[model samples]
Target: MSTPELHWFKSSYSSSNEPGDCVEVAVASAAVHIRDSKTPHSARLAVAPSAWVNFLAVVGERR
Candidate 1:
């Protein structure tokens, strides 16, 4: 199956004027897409929405 077109955006936490190490994400109905902002065309990761939520929760807890 062909990949759907995704509108990716950088995390709001990334406030640097110059591009640094950051990740981009695109939300889809079935999954969340994640990729290195510096390398958009490189390999990406796709995770279920629930998994994404859990991952974010874990990260937030560490903050």
Candidate 2:
């Protein structure tokens, strides 16, 4: 099996300036992928859609 290409987008909170630490995310049918915007080729983290939703909910409550 092969991995399909993902369309990643930068986090809205990331700095608008270039050469800064940033986070990127890509949503797939099975998982949400997260990675550093600067080192895109580096290892990434993937979580189930449900887990991602739960995470957002938890984080939202703290805001």
Candidate 3:
């Protein structure tokens, strides 16, 4: 009948509230979700737990 609800929140990694560069995250039992903070209603990217960890590893390497 109706869509489910998601308690999305801004990523802690986002240091400042300047503008533009912002991302949000939501963790669920099945997947880790990411969406643009500027457009919360837009499409999002969902990844498995292991995949999320691997992705962070790569991002950490670059930074």
Candidate 4:
């Protein structure tokens, strides 16, 4: 499938000087897009809105 059109945003914790380890995310329709910042053209994983919220909550608890 073709990649969806999206406006990507990097994590606030990402550093301007170091882009290698950063990830980019975008929201399209009811799905969320996730991809490596260094490879924008590469395949991205899409997650449902609810799943994305749960993932974030779990991640926040781990911090």
lDDT-superior candidate, 3 or 4: 4
Q: Report clashes for each candidate as comma-separated counts.
A: 0, 0, 0, 0
Candidate 3 deviant stretches above 4 angstroms = 1-4, 15-20
Residues 2-61 of candidate 1 have per-residue lDDT tens digits of: 978999999754646858678899999999999989889999999999999998998888
Q: Please give, for residues 4-52, the per-residue lDDT of candidate 4 as tens digits.
A: 6799999654667886878888988879889888888999998998898
lDDT of 2 by residue, 1-63 (tens): 999999999876566787568889899999999999879999999999999889888877876
Q: Which lDDT tens digits does candidate 3 get at residues 1-63?
A: 854577888776675766667889988877999999888888999999899989888988877
What's the best-to-worst order under TM-score?
1, 4, 2, 3
Q: Per-model C-alpha lDDT, please?
A: 0.87, 0.88, 0.83, 0.85
Q: Model 4 Cα displacement at 10 (Å)?
A: 0.3
lDDT, residue 35, model 3:
96
TM-score of every candidate: 0.83, 0.78, 0.76, 0.78
**In lDDT terms, how accurate is model 3?**
0.83
Off by over 4 Å in 4: 1-4, 13-17
- How does model 2 score by TM-score? 0.78
| Candidate maximizing TM-score | 1
Error of 3 at 25 (Å): 0.4
Which model is ahead, 3 or 4, in terms of TM-score? 4
